[model samples]
Target: MKKFALIFVVVLSLVLVGCGANSDKASNEKKEEAKTITFQSEDGKIEVPAKPKRVVVLSSYTGDLINLGVNIVGADSWSFDNANFKDALKDAKEVSEEDVEGIIALKPDLIIGSSTMKNKDKLKKVAPVVTFTYNKLNYLDQHIAVGKAVNKEKEATEWANDFEKRAEEAGNEIKAKIGENASVSVAESYDKQMYVFGDNWGRGTEVLYQAMKLKMPDSVKNSALEAGYYAISPEELGNYTGDYLVLSRQSSGDNSFMKTTAYQDIPAVKNNRVLEVESSKFYFNDATTLEYQLKTFEDFFLGK
Candidate 1:
């Protein structure tokens, strides 16, 4: 009887251990299932399974993710230049331009990026990567595309709508201040040439020209407006002469070009209508930077 009792006790302990192991297995399966999420790539098409908790952004798409209220594990350093992004992901790790190996080491479940990434194959080998190609589109469409990729399409649309409304209000105020005939030109001096941006450039040209109904001078019509962005001799600045000139300041130590005689004779210089702008905000047309550009324009041109 003593031997039988000992055997029974051993059997009970084994059964309890087996039950606990099964419970643990079930819990792990549930956790794995919970982690799964459908993520759309930058391409705005292909959807793949991504672990909802771990996300790595390799582009300015960090703004979209932030707007979507998603937490990012890592992001490209360039995104930090914008105040909105910097404030949103203060603790996020920075991924360098050539740091695919480092990114893979993070073991992120979803890799969000642009077409500019060099190590696409390597990144994909480590995890699922979604890339988006940015282009000139209606702001609403662009915002919606970003929202869809981040699984926040509805919220993105609403944000875009609100942005458009605010932009329209700002445009109206600018129109009131500048009047209908006030011509505007946006240009940057670089490498002894003047680069002018037009409707195709991703700044606020659409709102300025289309929404606000600002006039484009005839001199900048064919050359400046047609090519979207074109470089001309400093002597050709006469062609860009408008009522308001928005000049983007080249970086320091870039005096190699600006010291030339052609830039001095420009009407914008003589009239003192040239407003020097920050190069970083001028070139990068992301959401946060765009707002900065708009505010700068308002302060410089509208006296707001």
Candidate 2:
């Protein structure tokens, strides 16, 4: 009787162990099933992993996702100078617009890019692809759209609202310090070409016009602001110069243009209100870059 009882007890122990193992496997399967999601992309209805574990971005909007605390696995090489992304993306793989195979090897669960990317069909084969047409919406609106794509809309809205309030406060402070009618202009010299910008372009316009409430020179408002940007010859520089100038020189040691008699004749340069900025940093118009520009303004304009 004792030997029979021992055999039965051993069999019962084995059965309990097997049941536990099966339960664990089933739980793990359920967890894996929940990892994916269906996203309505610009291309059409496509399914992507929720909170995508690996994302490959092929646009300058990498900063947008980073600000939302998303994991970025790869990105385009164009945004190398964006201060917010440079350090974090330093070790990230650099993928080209047409590198579908390259992106596939990265094992991305989702791909984000511009609508103009080459080989869109090939990219879609590897993973779900979402493309953005940045020009269709204003800058802040574009950021919100990107946030929706990454499932970070709540954080994005909070940041946008906070940023707007801060910007308005900063603008009011500037007016109090420098008078409400102070004028500012953004200009850059690139490859022997000069550009004048309005409030939309990256070169401090958001801070100067939108945030600080500074006035643009009539020539700039009539030209650059209407068309987004205006290209002018070296001799025509004075036409766009304002009470303050945000000068971004692309090449170092090319003081040739600045040394010219025509350049020194600008009223801003004569009065020493020219704020020299690195072209690379000033080229991004996103909220992250705009914060950097704000800090710079605090120091330069208010002596804070």
Which has the greatest TM-score? 2
**Over the stretch 1-304, how does candidate 1's per-residue lDDT look in tens digits?**
9999999999999999999999999999887765445554544445545334567888756766776677787887667655557777786788854798778777777777778777887887877777766553454576577666556677878877776677777778877886868888777776656777776465456556655567777767777676777787666776776887777765563644445577667776777777776564456555555566667767776687
Candidate 2 Cα errors over 4 Å, as ranges: 1-41, 251-255
Per-prediction TM-score to the true structure, in the order listed:
0.75, 0.84
**Best candidate according to lDDT:** 2
Sequence-dependent TM-score of model 2: 0.84
- lDDT score, residue 196, model 1? 72
By summed lDDT, the worst window of 10 consecutive residues in model 1 runs over 42-51
The reply for model 1, stretches above 4 Å from the true place, is 1-45, 48-54, 81-84, 191-193, 224-226, 251-261
lDDT of 1 at 143: 58
Instruction: Write one digit per residue (lDDT tens) for candidate 2, span 1-304.
Output: 9999999999999999999999999999887667666666667777667677688888757778777777777888766655567876776788887777788889988888888888888888888888987556666776777777777677888888787778778878877887778888889898888899988777778777876678898999999887778999877888899888888875554647898889898888898989888887777666667777888777878887
